[model samples]
Each structure stands twice: as structure tokens, then as C-alpha cells.
Target chain A: MSDSPVQRLFAEPGLEWRSVSPKLTIERRLPLLGLLLFGLALLAFGRFVAEQSEAAGADLTGALFSGLAAAALVGAVVGWFFVVPRVVSAWRYAEREQDLLVSRGRLVRRLTVIPYGRMQVIEVSANPVSARLGIATVTLVTASASTDARIPGVPVDVAQELRDRLAAKGEALTAGL
Target chain B: MSATDAAPAAATQASASASTLRRLHPLTPFFRSWQLVGALAASGFGVFRDDLDKLKWIWRALHGDVEVSLLMRAVGVLLLVALALVFVSWLSWRVTGFAIITDASPSGTLLYHRGLIVRQRSQVRLNRVQSVDVNQPFLPRLCGLAAVRLDMAAGEGASVNLAYLRRQDAWALRAEILRHTAVARSRPTAATDSTEGAGGELIAEISTARMVQANLLDGVVAWVVLVVWVVALVVGGVVFGWRGLVTVAPGIVPVTVGIAVQLRRQVASMMRDANFRLRRTPTGIQTSSGLTSTINRTIDLDRIQGVRLEEPYLWRRLGWARVGVDIAGASDQSHHGASLMPVADRRDAVALIAEVTGARLDEAAVVPAGAQARWLDPWVARHLGVELLDRGAVTRWGRWRRTQFFVPYARVQSVSARQGPVQRRLGLATVYLDMPSGVQRWQAQHRDMAEAAALVGELAGQARLHRAPLRRLEPTLGTGDR
Candidate 1:
């Protein structure tokens, strides 16, 4: 039960990976749901424009556009609802003796290991939607800006606790930059 | 040299002097604002339409010269603007000053303040200095003046620029800071590294002729451009009829000229790298070179994140290569900053990379990209691969210009291994070693899936080994633990 599917899939024998709360599924995918609506609205707009134009085969044009758009919409629905949850489920972190490991994504997987001493700052915040869902996101900034390290949809208390612990560890293991 | 002291030992004893606020050269205003004044004069009255109108009204009231020529009025406005700029520059220079805040610590802090009204102040700890350099632009050099650029560790676009110091004073300041840093670090051997008027032991030197020759003969890209252009012409002629190809043939002139311009630029940079010399300092390497605007660059050995050697195909036969280094906080906007060796013997370039990163390429350990990687870039992927050493990782990639980058484990911010759907199908992945921004990043591209995974793990393990291992994070090893 402790082993995430991602940990088992990308197995490093001794490392024990910790997955985020299952609630992240809803929190991560809500914006995608909005994106899906936006796509539908764009399709409708295309059909409206097609109907208004005096071009030949306007209905045909509308049908062809709608068909491609509908197909894309269906594919997105499958990806957002089905493929995305699995990716979210795969999201995990492991705090080793010296460094922290964060791995996520399914089709194009990424695992980043950043040293505790390299952490410059740690931030924990929650938007209204996430706050209502009782969760917050923790972001870690290091001297190198591009090494993305974020743990999303952790319970608010858990996020705060993790941030404090990380800051303490970073201070205790302070290495000159 | 007349008023300012030039003795290295005296400078060291003074220790950048916490007691006195040293001002910039009196001619600093003239040198700094000349470019601004010239720009305003060139723009004439075109720059500020409203200001010009106001100036005209003031002139009509004061001079009562409605008969003044338009050109004369424009020239008058330009002269006024230039004068104002010069005045502002002088005032700003008067306010701009720096002093050592505390020499109590072996490694002290320098406080710099500038601006007449807005007034900005920043302090840089000597111990945190990544590197320092003396940059003398053409005008400043003519004036016997120089600017010192001090780079600090983990600086967020913040660097100390002390402009228009007398040349001796600049060198004295450099020596003082280096001595202070060495004293603070308890490295007595490094204390005598920066002596005024003396460069470190010369490691390598590139003659002006050799630099000009190598840069001008920089092939591969130039040749490729020619071949590709010819091929385009021929292919177009065959496909679209000779007449049509002729119609589009004029396009080739621009492309050809563009390539010529690129070659000219290479020659121009060669002039910049003229008399390129590399010396081994106690703390790092110092490069001093220039034809007109000379630059003296020092790169801290400990702050070196990545190093690369570039061997153009044409240079390969000539046994010439160039070495580049990425130092944290070292400015790379100018080609002069990152370049360690613009032109050197191939063996010397290799040795330079080894000296900096403590890693050398081993033919046995090199994992070359397989034919599968040919899909990446037919010209480049065949030569692409990575070599892992105890001290760092060496990534070799590039087509006609073979580049090898060494990223030491100590400076790696993070390790990442990623595989796309195609890479997954191909059983390959790319591993990236993250470094500070504005520097070249290293990647082990097109490695076997398992090898990539192992490489990531190995890198992470090596990175931890370089630093002190922390106490374990978990107490009870709850649900997250096995």
C-alpha cells in the first residue's frame, strides 16, 4: 500500500515514494474541465460563423468542422478524465538522506532530485477552489530556477508541516551557493 | 598611478579600506556620458517633440531671434540636451562612491552607493564573491581608466560595477579583494595570487594571426550553408522548371550575403579574442585579451558549473579547439565572459576542461548513441553520447562542430530523466542535469531507457556524495515507508 504504482513502475529498490492525496485528481483536473468547455464554445462559434457565411457547402463546412472538433473533444474528455487521473496518481515524492525526489507524468515521465541544501525558499499557498477542497500547493525554489519542484493538493496542515520541516532541513544542511 | 597607490602589499594591507569612501576618477563623468551626449546630438530635435516645441518658445522669448534658421535652432536644442546630460552624469558620478563596510572579518563586505535623488545602496560580502574582472572599454582605456565587475554567489541579477577607476587603483582593488578572500578562506598559498601589474603563470596563449586564421576558417556551418543552398537551387530547378527556379534564384543572393555576414562576425569576434591568453591563478583561471577594449576575466574554480570544448571540423585537422566555461554569477552576455580559450591546441583545450571540472572523457566509458538516435539528427546524433565519471558527467553532441560539456556533480542543481511516447517506443530517454540559468545546459540524449534511469539514479547518488548527507527525514517511516 505504501508503494505508489509509479514507484513500482520506475523501481529504485530501496527508495520509498510518497504519493499526494487522492483529492488532487479533482483539484488538478478542474482547470482541464474549463479548457474542455472552452474548446466546445470555440466549436460552436465556428459553426455559427459557417452558418452566417454565404459560402458554398456551408452546412457541409459546418459538419466537417463540427466532426473534427467533436472528435478532438471526445479525445480530450478521455484524456482529462481517464489518462489524467492515472498521471495524477503517479505523482509522488521521496525524501532521501540528502535530497528530495519528485516524479510525475505518465506518457512523458519526469523525476527530479534536488538537494535539501540547494533550496532557497519554500512556499505554500491555496487558491479559493483548492481552499474549499481543503488543500494547498507547496513549491520549492532553488538557485537554479528551471528545476520545477512542486507538490500540489496536499491537505493544508500537511502542506504547512512539510514546508516547516523542509525549511529547517535546508537551514541545518546549509551549503554555500 | 600618480595620486593612487599601486603597491600590491600596501593594497592588501589597506584591505579595500573600511575607513575611506573612495571616489571614481574625476574624468568618470566625461567618459560615461560621452556616448549618451553623442546619441542625443545625433537624434537632434527628433527625440523630444514636446521638449523641442517648449525650447522653441523659450528661444523666441529670450533671443527674439525669429530669423534663426531651423537647422540652427535644432543644433541649439541638441547642444542644450547634450549639456544637460553631461551635467547629470557629473552629478551622478559625484554621488556614486564605494567603501569597504567592514574589514573586521577576514572577508569583508563592500558597500556601494550611487544616484543623486533616487539613491541606491547594495552590499556584497567578500566571502561570497564568485569572481572579479577588470573591463576596460576603448574610451576608458584611452583615458587610463577601467571598471571592476564583481560577481557574487547566487546573485539575482545583482553585480557590483565600479566604473572609471584609475588603472592602478583598479588592479590594487582586485588584489586586495583576492587577498582578503584567501585570508578568510585560510588558504595562505592563494594569498599572493593577485599581484598588481603581474598576471598569473601563463598556461596557454593564442596569437592574433592564429585567432584570425581559425575564426575565418570556421567551416562546417559555412560549408553546410553553401551545400544546402546549391542543393536548394538544383532541386528547385528540377521540380519547378528552370525558368521558375531562375525567378526565385535572386533569393540566393541574400542567403549568400547572410552567410558572408556570419563569417565576418566570426572574424570580428576573433579580433575581440586577439592575443587571447590563459593563466592559472591559485583560485582559478585568468584570461586577459583584447586589441582595443581589453578584458581581464577571472573564473572561480569552485563556482564552475559546466565546461565545454568546441572543435569545428575544419579546426579538427588543424588540431585547434576552443574551451568555454559556465560559472555561476559570471556574466555571459558578452562572448568574452564564458570563453576560456577561444583558440588553443586540442590537447590544451581538453586539459583545460579537465583542470576545471576534474573529469576527462574516457573512450571506454562513452555511451554512444545507437542507430536509433540517427532519427534525432542524422548529422549530429551519430556522434551524440555521454560519459559518466566519478567527478562529473561529460555530454558530447553536435554535428560538424563537436562539443563536449562536462557538468561536475557538485554544481548540479537537480537531475531529471524524461521519456516521451516516441522515446518510450524507441526504448530511449534524455537525462538533463540542471544548472544555473544563462549558461549552456547539459543533456544525455538518446540513451537506452534502462541506462537513462540508471544514469539519473547514479547522478542523484553522486550529487549527494559530493555534499554531506543529511539525517533521514522520516521518524517512524509511516505509510510512505516500505
Candidate 2:
């Protein structure tokens, strides 16, 4: 079937809205993983002290080391199930023709919109992983930092195109003003 | 005199003749009077501990427990002496000279310089100044000095601190900046609006008790501390039995109580410091606070990029919401960061939103029509495969009040959805709507992904519509798709 005018126009734009890179997802979740590690460490320390007092033959130092390893495994599993998703949600963004939207939170979602005409600056950010993955983030800034909109996970080429187009549009808007 | 007209002429005077820099207080070098001597001493001592441990063998040799190692003993003594000298020198330097060079400008467009062997100078402009934070640590206070911190938006650090200001200069400087920012924002046109004001009569006086009550009611830090203490007590009992609990309980109880008391006082002072005056300016609404030092922030409604209303569960009970504005040309922390409207009742938040955005949120509480039609396809296409709860399961929109809304895309200023690995695997998405505050905002999340996107688009359209009047008219036809 031939593509409709609307669909064709949006096909290129829709590529702009695809999910963020999986690596970006992992990088953002490191903090949550750190927290999980801390919790597991605490759990292991408790378990080790208890085991040391209870066991007669086992060396206390050896038991403590084993407890830490066990705790880390449990923490990774629990964190993967519970915390990783929350972190991922907080670092997500979306793009559209008229504006850019950025949001975070699984339960309480906060979306910030930056109108194309209202954009004061557009920042194209890409880490080494994102660069390798061919994805970059387009951060659309309005007068307010809180209102800055980010569209993450766009193809590097698409992000560059969006930046050029938006910059042109922003210049026109400022010129009119 | 209008504050702008009174801006100090100090910038024009640039004579290298020491007279300009000399007038600055001698103690300006200590701008960061943050326990420099103590910090250095602690760090030096920390390094010395490892060296001391290595020198233990030398001590044994010196005592003839091992063959007398004269070389090792000599090196250890010399190292200790050098460390001790560095510590004393640092302490002496910390107590010595520091100075603040100020221009007549209220923003203190001056240079703050200090240090004997290493001289450092920082130039601050009035317009570059964002916020000034005045902090007094125990030592500086005991020494009758107030640390003046200037938070510049463009600066890389937390703030530029003038180690010790004669307290009087700090107050004058703060007042000067407040007056300057206010006047700078208020041109003749705004000044006229402020004085002729239909809005100035309605003053919101937040009773000190109300401020205190709100903070105490919403605070969970005290409870957390109490829980930690109880847990520690239980752990102590489990580990050392009765004897451990007895020894730890006394120390823990007093310390916890002391912390709680300190927290309460800090909260109370924080509340006491909370003061805001909203007035009509040529640009938009002017919000000034008496936090630590006075701060004046003028938000141009035309320039306001977005608005956010965040109310944590605890704050819901206190009948309060925090309002943040994305303002251009403001500091990263307050303007770009977060400008919190500390403890405002719902009506006040609504009024402030209306006044700031020039959008009446209270007038039309319901969402505009057309959710089922036009934008539905794009909405569904946007949210397809994302996991979403059926709208039936989603609860209250606003934290305190259970005001549900049926927002459409035309009213939405922005819409975005996010997913994690699990959500991605489940093909689920969580979407959010950025709407003008008040009844137009939903108290809860939309169960349908398509519906959320449509609502976001709806608000975005309205925001664009609002900007139509402000857009300048040009003779040239700007870039268009046609």
C-alpha cells in the first residue's frame, strides 16, 4: 500500500519518538543499582554476623565474604525487578513537530513541553555509548530550566536535522519578535 | 530615587593605584571562611596517620627492640615536624588577611581578593548576579563575622563567599540587589502599574504559626530519625544483650532528641524566613522573598516557558502545593532550577498561577472538548504497546482534592511517555500531560496512553493560542511550509 501524506510526513518524525537507547537506559539506572548494592551490603553484613555467631567450624572472615557475594546476587535480582524501571522512566523523553516533551516517574509523571517558537536554545547531547548506538538527545530549552524539554533516543542524523530545523525556526521567531 | 538610577558608579573607577583595592576590608582573602585551617589540618593529620603507622617500625628500632635505625628515626621526626609546620602555617593564613572590594552598584560589581603568596581576584557584574546567600558558621559567628555568599547563575561553584563582611555591608548589599532587580525589571510602565495597582490591596499575610504548623505537619525527617533510633536500640539489644542497650540507649535517646529539637528549630526558622510579595509588574508578577537575605525574582508571563505543580503525599494534608516556573535569564537553581512557593493554599496557588501566566485556571475547570476525535489516532500511535492501567483504576488527580479531569490534546502544552526494560518488554508506556495549573490538571494519571497524549496536545494548543497576542507583527512573511 502506498503511504498517505500524513503517514509519510510522520514516518520520519515517528522515528524521532522511538524508545531511548538501551545503553542510555542502563547508564541512567546506575544510581538505583548503587542504592540496591548498599542495601544488599547491609543485609549481607547482618547475615554474616549472625552466621559467624551461629556456626562453629566456618571461619568468620570466609563466611563474611560469602555473605557479601550472596547479598550482591539478591540485590541485583531485586533491583532489576523493582528499581531499574523507576530509574528508566525518570530519564525518558519524546519529540513532536510543534514541541518537544520530556517526562519521568512511573506513578507520578511530570511532562515538560518546549514550543518550537518558544525555544531559546537546543542542545544536542550524546555520550560515547549513545554515539556508537547512533542515538542522541535533543534538549529544547525555553526561558526556564524547569521547562526545558528533552527528546532522547533519536537517531543521530534525525537529531541533527531536528536541531537545524528548530534553530532556524527559533531564529525566525526571535526575528519576528 | 528609582533603584536603577541609583546604581553605583564604581565600575567607572579603575585606577590600579591600590587605593581602589585597598579600600576593601583586609579580611577579604578569607572569603571562603569554611574551616579551611581545620579541613587542611584534618587532611594532613589523616595522611600523617599512615606515615605514623609505617614509622612504628622505626619507633621499635629506636627503642632497641630491633637494631637501632638512626636514619629511619631521623626521617620520621623530620616528616612530623614538616607536617606540624604546614598545619600551623595554614592556621595562621586562615586567621590572616581577606578583603571585599565593592562598587557603588547594589549588586556589588566589585572584586573579592585574598591570600598572601597566591593572589586571586573575581569580577562580578550587577546583571550577572542571581542570588546572594548569607551563611554564618559557628566560628565566623564567634569571631563576629558573617560570610556573604553571592550565587551567580553563570559561576561554576556554589557561590562566591566574602569570608567576613561587616554584617552591615551584607545587609545593605542584599537590600541593594533586591531593590536593583526589582527596579531593573520595573520600567516606567511597570512602575506605573505597580503604584496604580488594582492588585496591591489584597495582601497575603502568612501567619508565622501557619508557616510553622505546615512544616511540622509535613515533616517526615523526625519520624525517620525515631525509627532509626528504635532500630539501632533493637540491634544493640540483639548484639550485646541488655548491657549494650543500656549503654547505647542513653547516648542514642539524648542524641535523637537533640537532633529532633534542632530540626524543629531549623524548620521554624525556615518558616519564619519564608515571605513572598506578589505585585503587578510591567513584565508579569514579581515574587520577592526574605529567605536568609532578601531575594527578588520578577517572572515575565510572556517569557514563562512552562509551569509545574508538585505536591508530595505528605504535603497534601497541609493544603499546600509547590509551584515552579521556568523563567529565562534567571539563575540555574531558582529560575531554571526550582522556585518553590513554600506553603500556599490551593486558592493562592490558583491565583498565583493566574497572575503569573495570565491564564485563568479557576474559570474553566473542565477540559475542552474533542478528545475522541481528530487527535486520537496520533495519540494511540504514540502510546501503542505501552502498558497502561485502565482509566478505571487510576485515582485522584490533585494530591489533596480528588478533582478528576478529562483533558484533550488541544489543551495540552506537552505530552510524553516513558518505559523501562520491563515496561518495554510488556509494551507498556506511562504518559504525562503538562497543563496550565488548577482544575485543568488531572489529579491522577490517565489509564489510556492515547488519551494522555491527546490531552497533552490539547494543552499545548491552548498555550500557543495564548502566545498569539504577544507575537510581534513583521512586514516580511517568515519561513512557512507553503
Candidate 3:
């Protein structure tokens, strides 16, 4: 059976796709895991201090403190082990002749399209943790306030290349306008 | 004043007059003081009323009698406030002034000087004038005065405003400025002659019944009232039993009724003139609207970025729609600047869109999205698609309320394509046409990824091909026919 016009229009015509660096996943997970461990240690230290105060005959409410700390520790552990990996895996970006596409989200997915001509600025930045992990984020700024398109967890070299290409394309395209 | 000598003499007179800075209407200070009086009345009544009540309670509690002197003091304070307000209004009126100076340049630069103490002076090149907004607030309207605000193509802070001018003077200034700045490049002399023939021709008039229906169906009152009523009933019933509903009923009724009345009045005021008129001249499309304070806005055809056709849910059922446009430098942040036709049938809307965009709706072929798009946008799949035209692209989408955007190749700021995780899995992508107006209508979603990529590439090429340098039309020699 022939496909309907709607099906034909939206049917996948597989094109060459470029994937981000696989090492980005490890880079994204390290900081999150570190933060989680740090938070757990802080909470444990607080609970210990509260218990020590209770032992010294002051009503320090050790039970309630410990319960809150345990709950937060559980939440941190879940976020570190579960949420971070999924979000990092979902991050993907593709460059076309005229525009750049960035998609990221686990459940409620969102895709942003940023054209080279519309990009007022293309910036690549890395924080201390990401730099240590050899990853950087690329941000595309436009005239509209709402559409802030950013692709995180790309290798530093890839981020720099994308920024330069986008900037060059933007300059070339904007000259006509 | 001979026909030959009259020209130079008039020019000299205009220059001489322009050199002298002038003050605003003497009554401007009084108009500005309206807020002061309102503030005084509210605070005075509130504070004095409470003070008097407290005093009476104290007297009754201690000596079982209240003195009348406290009431006299409150009255005296109220009178004093009124006197102070009048004095301030006078001072403000004395300081405010405006002047329009024709600079000694070929482009006819207009230097606008205004302000009381700080004295602000801004210059607007006559050719750069994009549109003029004539505003008359309640007091100014009653006093037969109006304010003229000139919107320029240069970014923000470029607009010049002259307030509290005689209504006739305001109209004259608008015409004179338009005439001075009118750039007739390719048009024949006959077109320029028609500009002075008469005012605009009435195109469409919104009926009172339609206005009321639009107001009610515009989703401001009906949905809000329904949601609030339901939430109130459910929550009140749960919290305080049947008596809770009864207690909330009286309060809700008065508030809802008050809001409904206010909303109706606001809609009515917005559609005061009710007539959507358009006039074509050598320079641009001229329009006048509003009942209380008539606004005259001029839309230069060259400055128009794109046009939008919208059908709200209720209006869609009735086959009614509205048309608006995105003009460069026009303050479209509010609905006032972009409004072309407030309400019309689909046919009329299409006609108006064609008139503005130079593209007929029927001429373009509509292509629906893929069947798999139903999974992504279940409500919009059938209605959403892109229409490729020779000169531009038109995209339509929405379930309850549909919107069609006409973006010409020359006006498209950028083109982009996106594919999310689900879209990647489904092989679908969304294409965006970033326009100058930042409106959401210019997007085509849920197309095949390859098709979207192809469309983006084609659109970019077309944009480059159609890109024309913006040129200001030179004033035609000897066409001073106006």
C-alpha cells in the first residue's frame, strides 16, 4: 500500500547524523556525584553534632535532625545515580547548512532551533569542574529573550569548533540583512 | 505673495517659527494633576474617616461625649490638600514646553525640544518617521487637545512626543510631517494627488453585537469565571460544608459582575470607532481608530516585516478571524500597534492579508504533516503544515484556534530545525522561521527530519536571493502636488 501524503511528508529520510563525544557522560556525572557525596557528608556531620549535643544533656532534637538528614541523603543519592545520567544521555545537538539544532529532556522533551543569522553571539565556556572533566558548554544568544539555546557536555575542542563555525556563519549571513 | 516668491517666503517663515521654542497647553499642568487629586481624595478619606471613628470611640469610652472640633480639623486638612494640588499643577504647567525645529540639513531633520526643568531635546530625521500615534486621554479629549507621538525606525528612545496640543493643530502637524517626509520614488504623480483627495475609506465596521460576542468569547471572562466558580464551590464545600458555599456565593456574584462590566467597558472603549478603515497613498497606509481618543497611525508598506491571520476558538467556529502585521519600529508589544482588522470573516481576513502581504491565501498549496505527527501533536496534526509560495512561506497550526503566518523570503531573519529524543526516534523535526517580530506563529512543527532540513536549506537560499538593501526613497522633484 502506498503511504498517505501525511506519512510521506513526516516519514524519516535518514540523513548523516553527528553524535556528541561519549566521554561527556562521565564528565557530566562526576560533579553531580561529588556534590551528592559532599552533601551526605555534611548531613552526617550535622547529625553527629546533634547527637553529641544530646549526650551533653541539651535537648538537641537528634531524632528529627537525623530523619531530615537521612531523607535528604536518600534524595541526593537518587539524583546522583539516576537523574544525572539520563539527562546527560539525552543531550544531543546537530548542525545544518543554515541552522543548529539542540534537543535535551528526559520526559518532557524540548528541541530548539537556532539559525546562524539570528545568533547575536556564540559563546563556549567551561567551569572548574567541567574543565577538569575536559568538557565545555556552547550557548547561542539571540534577540528574543526567551529562546536561550545551550548545548552542554561537549568536549572542549568540539565546543570551540562549533563556536567558531557558528560565529563565522553568523557574520557571513548577517551581512546581507 | 506671488506663486514664485510664496515658496521661499513660506520657507523662511517656517524656519523662523521653528526656531522659537513653544510651551504646551496652559492646561497641561491641570491635566497632570488629576492623579494628585485622586491620591489626595483616597488617602484623606481613608485616614480621616478612621481617625474620626477612633476619636469618637475613645470619647464614648471615657467621657461618653465626642467633640465636633476633630471633624472640622479633618475638613480643614482636606481643603489644604486640594489647595496644594492646585499649586503644584500650576507649577508643572508653567514649566512644560515643546518646540519643533527644522534643522539646516538636506534630510529635513526635526529637533524636538520639551520638558520643564531637565529640558530634553531629541532629533528625528523626517524621512525616518515610521508612524505617528495621536493620543487623547479623557481630560485632554474633553479639552479638545491631543498628544502626537512620532515613532521612528531607529531603536527605542527615538520616538518624539508633543503633548496637549490643540486637536486641529495636532492633525495639521501629522499631515505636514507626513507630507514633508513622503518619499515618492517609483510612483506616478497621480498617486501623490490622491493622498490629498480626502481621508481614508471605511473598509469594515465592527457591529455592537459582534463586539460583545468577541469580548465574551475572547477567553478573558468566560474561562476565568468558570474556573473560579468551580474551584470556589469544590474547595468551599469541602472546607466548610454547605454553609461555606452560601457564604462565598454573595461575594463571588458581586465581584464577578463587577469584573464582567469592567471587561465589557474596556472592550467597548477599545473598539470605540468600530470602523477599520484603510487609505492607500504614495507614502503608506493611513488609519484612524478609537472612539474616546482617536488614533491616527500610518503604516509604511516597505517597513512591514510580516502579516498574521488569527482565528480564536470561538471565532473559528463562527468562521471569523483577525489580521495583523509586524511593522519595523512599531510597538507591537501591545496589540494596539499591529492590529489591522480586529474582527472579520475568514474571507475578509484573507483579502486584507493579501492586500498587505501581496500573496493570496488560495494561491498557496497546503501540505499536511506526516501521520506520525499525531503522536507528537495529537490536536494540531491535521491542521498544522507549511505552504510553500513563490515569494514566501506560510505556516498554519492549532487545534481550537488556528494561526497562519506569511513570512516573505526577504523578511525571514533566520531558519532553524530541531529534533528531540522522541522526534529523533520518530524521525520528526520542527522548523522555525525566526522573524523580526518575535511572534510564535512563524514555525512549522512535526515534519520529517530530512524534509525539515531540506526546507531550511531552501529557505536560507531564498532569503539570500531576496534580500534587498533598505533604501529611503528620494523626494520626487516637482511633485509638491500636495
The residue ranges of model 3 lying beyond 4 angstroms of the native Cα positions read A1-34, A49-177, B1-19, B52-83, B102-129, B152-160, B179-197, B200-202, B206-246, B250-273, B312-319, B327-337, B420-426, B469-482
Q: How displaced is residue B387 in candidate 2, in Å?
A: 24
* Alpha-carbon runs more than 4 Å astray in model 2: A1-114, A118-166, A175-177, B1-18, B22-34, B40-120, B132-149, B155-159, B175-211, B220-241, B244-363, B366-415, B419-429, B432-444, B462-482
Q: Which ten residues in a row have the lowest lDDT in candidate 1 chain B?
A: B470-479
Superposed by TM-score, candidate 2 places the C-alpha of residue A21 at a distance from the truth, in angstroms, of 16
Best-matching candidate per DockQ: 1
Fnat: each model in turn: 0.52, 0.13, 0.15
Candidate that scores best on TM-score: 1
Q: After superposition, how far is residue B312 of candidate 2 from its true place, in Å?
A: 7.3
Give the per-residue lDDT of model 1 (tens digit) for A1-177: 235433432545577777888888787778777767867976997779796997888878788778867876886788777987898797888887788888888888887888887787898989988898998888888767678888887889888888898999988776533
| Per-residue alpha-carbon lDDT of candidate 1 for residues B1-482, written as tens digits (9 for 90 to 100) | 11221232234445544346679999999987888866765675565564778666756856855556765786698688778888999999878888864433335667687888998766665766767899899988998999998886545477788998999889888888787666556565454455643567888888777887787677447657767877988898889888996676688678879988876776668667987778888877888888889989887777677788888888989898888877665556422238888988888777778777677755437888755777756678878988888888889988878888887776677787776777766767788887766556678888876667667878877876675321111111111111
Residue ranges of candidate 1 with Cα displaced over 4 Å: A1-9, A13-15, A39-72, A164-172, B1-19, B45-81, B103-105, B189-197, B219-257, B334-337, B375-378, B468-482
Estimate every model's Cα lDDT from 0 to 1: 0.74, 0.49, 0.66
List CA RMSD, all candidates: 8.5, 14.0, 8.6
Candidate 3 or 1, higher TM-score: 1
Q: Give one clash count per candidate, in the order shown.
A: 0, 37, 1
What interface Cα RMSD is found for model 3? 6.3
Q: What are the per-residue Cα lDDT tens digits for candidate 3 across B344-438? A: 88998898778776878757678777668989878779998889887788888877768887877776665655556777667787777765543
Candidate 1 CAPRI category: acceptable
